[model samples]
Structure formats: structure tokens, C-alpha cells
Target: MAILIDENSKVVVQGITGREGQFHALRNRDYGTKIVAGTRPGKGGEQVESIPIFNTVQEAIDETGANVALTFVPPAFAKDAVLEAAYADCQLIVCITEGIPAKDEAEMYNLIKNNTKSKLLGPNCPGLISPGKSNVGIMPHEITLPGNVGVVSRSGTLTYQAVHELTQLNIGQSTCIGIGGDPVPGMSFIDILKEYQEDEETNAIVMIGEIGGTAEEEAAEYIKNNITKPVVSYIAGVTAPPGKKMGHAGAIVSGNKGTAKAKMEALEEAGVLVVSNPTKIGKAVKEVI
Candidate 1:
């Protein structure tokens, strides 16, 4: 079973009238996601791709019994969209918009921290897919399949690259989560790791990390103490120069901290098999599993 979503999830689009929202809403619905309703301020009472639109999230939830909300609103309005979803009692909210201010993200996170029933995915992420069952975000659904491997990553394109390699080697995944490369993303590597550890369908895990933050290092420590499943990890940006931001907003090296070598060393110490090369991710997983 998937962690955050599955075949039974009733989803709603928060910015359904916009170009990106309409496009992905149709794609996700075609992939078998139960998209029950959508929200667009002045476009209420209209329909896009046959899904009814509402002026507010509460109205959409009240009318459609929507438990999941996907936000494609612009970055400036993303925080309010997320808050509206949370207040409307959407159990799971996935914000696909990128470039949201860090302070806004922090505030949105704080608003939902005490709401035990709600969970957020990303503000600059590709979202997660439980292959063969449901596709939530913009990840190419055609490349994934149902299997025993669970994959989680901080980078979106890198997550796709690793999944492609695994698929080529006939290593299908139970769930693949792109947790966003922002400094203060909604979910942490350890959070996804714990879910995978408890999932009976998952046999092994692949973690893809990049240089910049100590998230990988912290995850390694958690694995050393609590995880039992075999894990293979890949840390990107080994050749990145110090103090320069990489593609991700969070990917920056500061002196000796947050370096690729440092993260790899920590993972190795935690008994995780670390791969230095991206193309070798699948090979490393095969060796471990």
C-alpha cells in the first residue's frame, strides 16, 4: 500500500482553472485518481474536464467529500491556498507550486503542525506516485510500476533519473516520493523512511540526496538507530564548489558542512551502501537487495 494516497483517495484541485492546474488535473484523473472537485475563486459553478469548480475549498469539500487537495496556484498565493485546504479539513494537501517564500512556507507549516489529521507534501516538488495505483503530481506516470522497492528523493529530476534506472533493471517501486529540494520542505527524508520501514510491501529503499543541507546526515543517524530494511543511497553534487548554490535553492555548500563526501561518510557509517555515481544507482540497489 502507498503511504499518503491510493486508489480510494478523493482529490480536489485548488487552482483548477489555470493552465497548469487544468493540464495536470486531467492527466491525474486519466491516471485513475479520483478527482472529485476543483476550486477557482470567480470560476465557481463552471466545469473543467467535467470536474465541478467551487469558490472555496470548504465548499468543494462539503460538496464532493474531497479529502485530498492539489494546489497549482502561483507561488505568491500558494501559502493561502494551503491554509485554506488545511482549514477545510483536507486530510492530505500537495502543493506543486514552486518559488514560495521561505517565511510563507514556515507559516503554512506551523498552521498545520498541530493538525494531526492533515499532511503536506511540497511547495516546489514533483509529488509522489504509487505506481499502478495512483499518480498525484507531475512525474511521468508511464515510467513507474508496482514492486518492492521504495524510493525517496530531495531532487525532482534526479528522482526521475534514479527511477528510470531502476525500471530499466526491472526494479519496480512500491512508492516514489520527491520531497522537494527547498530548505524547509514539508516532509523530511526520515519521515518517508519511517513510513517505508513499516510498509509490508516495501522490501528495500533507495534514497537520493544532494549537497547543501544536513538532512541526509540526519537521516543516516535515524537509519543507524531504527531502520532495519536494506537501503542504498546516492548523494549528488560531489564536484560542486564550496559556497555555491546548485540547481536547488537548498543545494549550497558552506565550508566543510553539507558536502557530498560528508553525507556519504555518514551514510556509510550507518551501514547504508552509498553510490557516488548517478548511473550506478540501480546497480547499487541490486547489490544491496
Candidate 2:
């Protein structure tokens, strides 16, 4: 019982003809995801890896009953692809394109909020994986195994690193979600946390956050008030200089706000076992569990 997707999800690729789209589509298919159809305007009737292609998302959904849309469109055209998927009523829309203008994300977010039932994952994210069940975006498939741990992270590589470490330690995960490092990403830590809290299959949780935004702080509050499961956290950018932007788009330290220390302190106060070092994430979770 994974959140967002499972074995029953029929997926459609929005930019199926492009290099990234086709590449990940094949990888996802090989990982046992149900790749039902794809959409490529002017390339309809053509196929990639034997998957049928349609000109529009509506046509693809109507023909294939695809409920999940994986988008690999360019930054400039990402919003339109997302809007098309939302308008097509795709239940889960995962956008892997990065560098989209913040305003465009905000606009698309509001449009989805007011008009559709679509739940968007990322505009600059690694996407989610339900190990041994389904793979959605760009994360490596072999690093995860099915277990009771639930992972949610804002950084893609960090998500992978943590999952790899957990797998190495024989602590498999129920779901691993990368919520993206964009300022206005589709999903939040609290959103994923709530889902994990309610999921019967999940026994523990691992939260990977970075310096920047009050997201981790808000999630800490929610955990303090609501969650009872064991939680271990790792916050990056502890050694980062203030007022400087790090690798991720949202990873910047400002004056007295969004600091790694502050986030770590908040999690600590919330009864979360906070790991100061990234490499020790798996060990920390093991201790808590």
C-alpha cells in the first residue's frame, strides 16, 4: 500500500518522444510500472519501446485509461504539459523538469487547486518509488527494497543516498518520495508525513530536509502534535554560509530564517531523532526503529 502510486497505476508519458522522456519511460517500464500510453504532438501513431503515443493527454487517457502522467517536457513548456495533464484529469502528475519560473509554478499550482483533482509531485524532483512495485521518475530502481520505512526528502540525490544506506542496512522502505528543492514544490513534508502516518504498512519515517524555507519547521510542529511513529531526520546545509545559495534552488540561508540549525532544533524539540551528519542517516533510523 504505497502512497500516490502502486502496481495498478497506468501511466502516460507527456513528452514521450524526447530523450529524457523515452529514457526514463523505458526504465520505469522495465521496473514493472504499467506504461500504458504516451503523448507527443505530431508524433502520434509512432511508438517508443512499443508504447503507443497519442497527440494529446486527453486522447491518451481516453484510450488507455491512464491515471498517472509522467512529464519530461522542457522548462519553458512544463506548465502547459502540467495543465494539460490536470485538465485531462490525471490523478497523479509527476513533473521532472527543472528551472521552471516560480511564477509559472504558482500559476499551475493554483490552476490545479481550483480546477482539478490532480496531485502534482515535482517540477524539479526525482519523483517517488514504491520498491518492487512501481517506479515513477528518475530515481534508480535497484537501490530500494520493500519494507516498513517511509522516506520523504526535498533533495533528489540525498533521497537516493538515504535509501541506499537504508537498503544496505537491511531497512527497506514502503515508499521513497522526493518532493523537490524548488521554493514552491507540489508536495510538502507535512503532506507526505500525514500520508505516512495513516498508512498501515509504514512503521517508521525518515525526513531529509535542507537549509531554506520553514517547511521543515512546519513539519516538526505537525509531528510533535500529531504523529506517534518513530521519526529520524537529517537536515543538510549545516556548514553552509549564511546569505549564500547552495546547490538546490531553495537552498539558501537568510538572516535568522531557514537555517539548518533552526530546523534541526525544531525537529529535536518535536521528539525527532535528528542526525547532524548525512552519512549517519541510516544508523540514526536504525537506532530509532
Candidate 3:
């Protein structure tokens, strides 16, 4: 039982007419996603990649019964796209668009909680995928393998790196979720941790996190008290100078909180195996097993 999405899921691409949107839609379709419709305002009654297009999410859902939405809407209108999907009753909304304002995400989160019961994966996320099942975002499916270990990360590329390394060790993953590299994301480490903890197929977990967020600490606390699965973590931005930001826009540390050291301490204290080097992630997981 993979979390969020699998092979049977149906998806609608919001802003499917755009170049990026079309590109990913084609890629997702080729990857075996059940892409039934697309949403692009004023471009209704057309088709992209053979999937029907509509002016709004409501129309797309009404006509095609799409339960999942993968958003490629630009940063400025990304909030509206999410709200539209929520209104259309999409069970899961995966926002692949980046740079959405924090305030807008707060509003979108509120809307999801208040008006709709839909689970939002990200406002600035890579969405999600279950290898050999379904993929909705930008992850290349060829590198993934299906197995017992579950993975979740804040960085997209790091997620792949962890999965690739695990594969080299002949350790396939049940699922790999990239929750996004944003200051505020819809799905936190806690959220994914809870899902992974309950998922029967996931016997162990690997969390790939980076600097500049208290999310890892929060997940550490949860793992210490709640989760029973073997957990391994890798914290990026270790070599980053104090009070200095890293490459990713969300990679910034100021006070005592949100440092790689602080997160590592919390994770270590919580009984999570912490890796000191990025390249040693697979070896560390190997040690845990």
C-alpha cells in the first residue's frame, strides 16, 4: 500500500496548455499515469496529449471524474489553481509550481481545511510517485525501484540521489515523496512520516532533509514518540557557514533554529541514524538494516 498515489489513480493537469505543463503531462502519461483531462482557462474543448482540456478544474472534474490534480500553474496564479481544484473536489492536489508566496500557501491551506477535505501535497513540491505505480510530478521514473523502504524529502534532486543510491545497494523503495524545497509546504515531514508509518509495504524509512527549517526537528520529535519504523536521515547544508544561506531559496539559517547541526542533534537524540556525509546515505541505511 503506497501513500497518496499509485497506478490506478486518475489525474488532471492544471495549466496543461503551458510548455512546462504539457511537457510533464506527456512525461507522466508516458510513465503510466491515468491522465484524463487538463485545465487551462479559455482553452476549453481542446486536447493536449490526447487528454481533454477545460477552462476550469470544475469542468474537468465534472466531465472526466479526475480525483487528483497536478498543478503546473505559474507562481502568480498558483493559489487560484489550487483553490479551483479544491472547489472541484479533487481528493489530492499536487502543486508542482514553485515560488508561491507563503501567505498564499497559508490561504490555500486554510481553504483546503475549511471548504474541502482534499489532501494537498505541495504548493512548491515535486508532487509524488510510487514506482511502477503512478507518477504525477517531474521525477524520472526509470531510476526508481519498488521495494520495502519508504522515502520522503524536501529537495527534489536529493530524493532521486537517495533513491538511486538505495537502488545501487539493491534496496528498492515502496514510495519516494518529494515534499518540495519551500519555506512552507503543504505536506511536512510529519505528514509523510505518519503515512509511511502506517503503510504496510514500507518496512523502513529514509528522510532526506536540508538546512533552514525546523521541520526535521518536528519530525524527529514525532519519530521519537510515535513511529516504530527504522529511520535514517541525511541533513544537507552541513558545510554552510552559520547565518549564511545555501543554494536553494529556502536554504537559509539565522538563529539557533533551522541549522543542520540542530536538526542532526534532534534526530540523533530521537534514535534516528544520522549520516554525516551526503555520499554515505546508502551506507548509513545499510548499517540500519
Candidate 4:
């Protein structure tokens, strides 16, 4: 089965009165996700595309039995929004806000890890799509297909590119998760890797990483010991200079650590097929499986 979300998920959009919240929520609904409820501080009793709006997450859940929360709140209020979802016991919380403070994100991440049963996807991620089943965030569903390849990525753009290429090669995916590229994303590469390894529908995996974090290296260690599926990987920012901050806040090289070379080398040593060129990632996956 698909990881994280599926056709049965009933979603509540936090800050659903906002432009981004309305657009993506309705779009995901059109993609067949259950966009059942929405939360706005004072916009209760309103409706966006017939999705009922409530004053709070708990209210939405009480009214619609919403098990998933998609957040489009501003950076300043992102942590509060996530907390609301977590405390409401939403099974899956996908936060799409990108400019949240690192401290705020870390606090939210830790609380979800230690105190709540809710699984948080991202604070700056593009959310996920279980193709032909559900779409929960801003990703274009046209580029995906229902198949056995599970994809996880740190970059939203790269996730789309990898999925597009895989679909082009006629290899569809089971579920694709953009775990976000924030310095303190709620979910990690290792976490999603475990889910992918356990997902029966997933026969292979594609991972898109960016330079500037030790996450890929950590995932490599876990994959070596745990995962049996063929995994193809591409690390972006290969040419980024040390101390240079790349597009994403987490994508920066420090001294000899967090370099693309180091991440690629680690994954290669772990028996993962690491592709040097991002464009050839789909080909690499095809070769392995």
C-alpha cells in the first residue's frame, strides 16, 4: 500500500481562506483527495469550493472526521498551525510554508517526535502524491503515474523532475514524498526510507537529495542495513563551493562535510546506485530494476 496518505484520507486545510490554501486544497480535491474541511481563525461557516471551513482544527475534525491536515499558514504562525493539527491528532500533517524560523520548525519537529502520534511531512515541502489514489499538496498530478517506484526528495523541484522522468520512462510511482529542504524539516530521509522499504506496493525507490546536509549519508547507513529494494539516487548542488549557501536553507557546504561528493560516496559505498547527473536519474533506476 501507499505510505503516508491515500484515497481514504480526509484532509483539513489550515488557513484555507488564504490564496495558496484555497488553490492547492481545491486542486488536490479535484485530484480525488478528500478535502473535507478547512480551518480559519474567524472565517468559520464559510466554504471554499464547497469544503467546509471551521474556526479551528479540532472543530474541523469534530465536524468532518479529518485525519489529515495541509497547512498554508504564514511563517510566523506555522508552528502554531502545526501544533493545532498535532494536538488535534491528525494522522498526517503536511506544512507547505517555506520561511518558518529554524527554531520554530525544530520545536515542532521534536514535539511531534516525542509527544504526538501525528506524522509531519514538511514545513516547506511540496507535500506528497500517491498517484491515482490521492494528492495532498501543491505538486502537479499530471506528471505522476500509479506504479511501484517510491520517491522521496529534499527538493520540491527535483521531486517533480524525477517523477516526470520516471513517468516518461513508463515507470510509475507508488507514492512520492517531498520531505522539504528546510534546515529542520519534520521528517527525514531515513524515516521515509523505512516507510518505502516496508511498503508492499513499492518495488524500487528514487531519492533526490541536495548538497549541504548529512542526511543522505545517514540514509545510506540505514539503507545498507535495512532496505532490500533497488534505490537510485541523485544529489543536487554537486558543484557548490564550501561555505556557499545554495537555494535551500539546508543546502550549504561546511568545510569537508555536507558536500555532494561525500553524500554520493557514502551512498555508493552502501551499495546504492548513486547517479552523478541529476538528468540521468531515471536511467539509473531503469538500469537497477
Candidate 5:
């Protein structure tokens, strides 16, 4: 059982006319996701192979019942693309574009978070996948093996590495989600954690976070109180200097807050097994499970 998506999800690519959009949407569709329709204003009435393209998301949804939306537009248009999908009521809206303004990210988050229409995944994310069930975004499907472990990560690179390592160790995952490293990402660690906690097929959890925000610390607190599942965690940017932004826009450290050490301490206090080395993520999950 996957947390958010599975064989039942029907997807619509918002920027399907673009190169990246066409590539991933087709890749995902070929991988078994039901890519029912696509949306690109002037390219309406066209086709990305067999899938139909509509002028608007609502048209796509109304025509094909596409419940999931993935956006692969440029940074400047990301906010509008996402808001359009949200208004069209895509059950799950995934924004794969990076470099969106923080204010724009916040606006989308606030509006969507307040609405019951959509559950937004990311604005700079790799999207998510339920191996053998469905694949969305750019994460390769070959590295995954279907099983029970549920993975949630802030870093897309770490998410892939963790999944690959787990598969190498013969540990299959039920679902793997890269929630993106943007400062104002639509979803948080706690959101995915809650879903994992409620998912009956999920027996253990692997949470990967990085330096930047108190999200990891907040998730630690949530795990302390609400989740009873065994958890393994890895926080990146351990040696990063204060006031310097790392690879991610949100990966910044100020004073004592948002440091890797601080996040590690918080998770440890909540009884989570914290691994200092990123390479040990698979081993950590193996032990916990």
C-alpha cells in the first residue's frame, strides 16, 4: 500500500508540451501511471503520442478524470501553473520546477493548505513513486523494489541513494517521496510521516532531512508523540558553515538554528535512530525494520 499514489492514480501533465514535461510524463505513463491527459494552452487539441492535450487543466480533468497533476514549467510560471492545477482540483499536485520565488512558494502553500481540493507535494521536488505500482516525476523506476518500507526525504539525491542502497541490500520500499529542499515546499516531513503511520502495509520509516529549517525538529516532535513506528533518520550538511546556503535554497544555517547537529540531536531525543553518515542510511533502515 503506497502512501499517496498507486495504480489507481490518473495523472495530467500541465506543461506537457515542453521538452521536460513530455519526457517525464511519457516516461511515467510508460512506467504504468495512468497519464490520461495533458494541458498546454495553445497546444490544445494536439497529442503527445496517444494522450490528448487540453487547453486548460479543468478541461483535461473534465475530459479524462485526471486526479493527479504534475507541472514541469519554468520557474517564473511555476506559481501560475500550480495555482491553475489547484483550482482545477487535482487530487495530488506535483510541482517539479525549481528556483521558484519563496514568496510565490508561500502563496501556493498557504492557498492549497487551506483548501481541501488538493494535496500539494512540491515546487522543486522530484515527485514520488510507489514501485511497481506507479511512477511520477524524474526518479528512476529501475532502482526500486516493492515491499514495505516507506521513505520520505528533503533531498532528491539522498532519496535516490537511499532507495538504491536499500534495494542493493534486498530491502524493498513501498513508497519513496522526495519532498524537495525548497524553503517553502508544499508538504512537510510530518505530512508524509502521518500517512506512513496510518498506512497498514508500512512497518517502518526512513526520514532524510537536511540543514535549513526546523521542519526536521518539528517532525522529531511529531514522531515523539504520534508515531509508534520504528524510524531511521539522516540529516545532511553536517560540516556546512553558519549563514551559508548549501546546495538547496533552504539549506542555510544561522546561529545555532537549522544546523545538522541540532536536527540530529532533536531526532535522537525523540528515539529515532540518527545516522551521521549518509552512506549508512540503508543499514540504519535495515536494523530498524
Candidate 6:
């Protein structure tokens, strides 16, 4: 029982007529996701890769009984797409679009909180994959394999790197979730950590976190008190000059609360294995076993 998605999940593709949407939807279908319906505004009668397209998410859900949604809408309309999915009662909404305005995200966040029962994965993320089950996001299929460890991360490329190293070590994962680097997306490190801790197939966990935010600290607190599974974590942004911005704007550590050093210290004190080198993640995880 990995988090968010599993084999029984039936998915709908939002913005199905667009090139990106159609391509990934077909790919997801091929990857064993039950992609049963699609949404494309006025192209309601069209069929994309044999899946029926509808004018609204409600229409698609009604026709296909799709409980999950994979959205490929443009950034400008991404919030609207998510809201539509949430309102349609899609149990899981995976938003693959990046670069959503903060204000738009706030409104969407509030909408999801107040009105929708749907659980959101990401607005700027690679999405989640449960091995031998379903993959509904943009991550490459070849990198993952079924195993005992569950992977959760904020950085997309860094998540890939961790998976690659783990696969090389022949320790594949039960599920991997790229919760995204965005400030206001759905899932956080603590959220995924709770899910991973509850997952029976997952014997261990690997968390890839960036240098900013109090997220890692919060996760460390959770680990100290609740998480029982062996956890190995890597925090990025070690080389960035103090007070300078780096890759993701949200990755800058300001004030006393959100530095890489501080986060690592917290995790280490919690009895969580915190690795200094990103390249050594697999080896670090192996030590726990």
C-alpha cells in the first residue's frame, strides 16, 4: 500500500487535446495507468488514444468513473484545471504544470482546502509512481523498480539521481513521489513521510530535500516522534553562498530557521541518517540495512 496511487487507480487526462497532454496520457496508459477519459473544452466528442474526451471533468468522470486526474494544462489555466478536477471529486489530482503564479496557487490552495475532497500531488512536479502499479506523471519509466524502499523528495532532478543510484545498488523502490519544489503545492515532506511510514511494503525511505524552507525541519520533528522506518536523507544547496539565491527561488535559506546545516543537524539529532554527499545516497541507505 504505497501512498497516493496504486494499481486500481483510474485516471482522467485534463487538457487532452494538447500535444503534451496527449503524449503523456498515451504514455501513462501504456505504463499501466487506467486512463479512461479526457477533458478538452470544446472537443468533447473527440477521442484521444481511444479515450473519450469530454467538455468538463465532471462529464469525463461520469463517463469513465475516473477517480484520479493527471493535468497537463498551461500555467495560466493550471489552477482552473485543478479546481475542475477537485470539484469533480477526483480522489487524486496530479498537477504536472510548473511556473504557476504564487497568487494563483494561493487561490487554488484555498479552493482545494475549502471545497474539494481531492488530495493533490503537485502543481510543479514529476508526480508519483508505484512500481508494478501505475505512473501518472512525467518521470521516466525505466528508472524505477519494485523493492522495499519508498522515496520522497522535493527536488525533481535530485530524485532521479537518488533513484538511479538506488537502482545501481540493486535496491529498487516501492514508490517514489516528487512532491515538487514549489512553496504551495499539495504534499509536503511530512505528508509523504507519514504515508511511507504507514506503507507495509516500504522497509526504508530516502528523502531528497533542498536547502530552503522549514519543511525539512518539520520532517525531522516527525521522524523523531513518529517515523519508525529507517530513513536516509540528503539536503541540497551546500555550496551556495549564505544569503544568495540559488536554483529554485524558494531554496534560499534566510533567517535562523531554514538553513541546510540546521536541517541536517535536526535530522541527525533525530537519529535519521543525513548524508552530506548527494552521490553517496545509495551507499548511505545500504548502511541502514
Residue-level error in angstroms, candidate 3, position 179: 0.9
Clashes of each: 0, 0, 0, 0, 0, 0
Candidate 2, residues 1-289: lDDT per residue as tens digits?
9788889999999898999999999999999999999998899999998999999999999999999999999999999999999998999999999999999999999899899988999989999999988999999989999999999999999999999999999999999999999978987899899999999899999999999989999999999999999999999988889988786768878876799999999999999999978789889888988
Off by over 4 Å in 1: none
What are the C-alpha RMSDs, in order, of all predicted structures?
1.1, 0.9, 1.3, 0.8, 1.0, 1.2
TM-score for predicted model 2 compared with the true structure: 0.98
lDDT of 1 by residue, 1-289 (tens): 8677888888999899999899999999999988899999998999997899999999998999999998999998999999999988888888899999999999899888876467889979999898988888889988887898999999899999999999989999999999998878888899899999999889999999999989999999999998999999999999988988787779989877799999999999999999888789889888888
Lowest lDDT 10-mer window, candidate 2? 247-256
Q: After superposition, how far is residue 135 of candidate 5 from its true place, in Å?
A: 0.9
Instruction: Give the TM-score (vs. native) of candidate 4.
Output: 0.98
Compute the lDDT of residue 278 as modeled in candidate 4: 71
TM-score of each: 0.97, 0.98, 0.96, 0.98, 0.98, 0.96
* Clashing pairs in model 5, backbone N/Cα/C closer than 3 A: none
After superposition, candidate 4 runs with Cα above 4 Å error: none
Tens-digit lDDT track of model 3 for 1-289: 7888888788999989999999999998988889999999988999986899999888888888899999999999999899988888898999999888888988888878888888888877777789888888988788889888899999888888888888888888888999988766887899899999999999899998898878899999999999999999999988788776565667889787889999999999999999987667788778877
- lDDT of model 4 at residue 170? 92
Which wins on lDDT, candidate 3 or candidate 4?
Answer: 4
Q: Give the C-alpha miss distance for residue 224 in model 3, angstroms.
A: 0.6
The models' CA-based lDDT, in order, is 0.90, 0.93, 0.88, 0.92, 0.91, 0.88
Model 1 residue 96 lDDT?
A: 91
Worst lDDT window (10 residues) for model 1?
110-119
lDDT of 4 by residue, 124-225 (tens): 999999999999999999999999999999999889999999999999899999999999988899999999999999999999988887999999999999
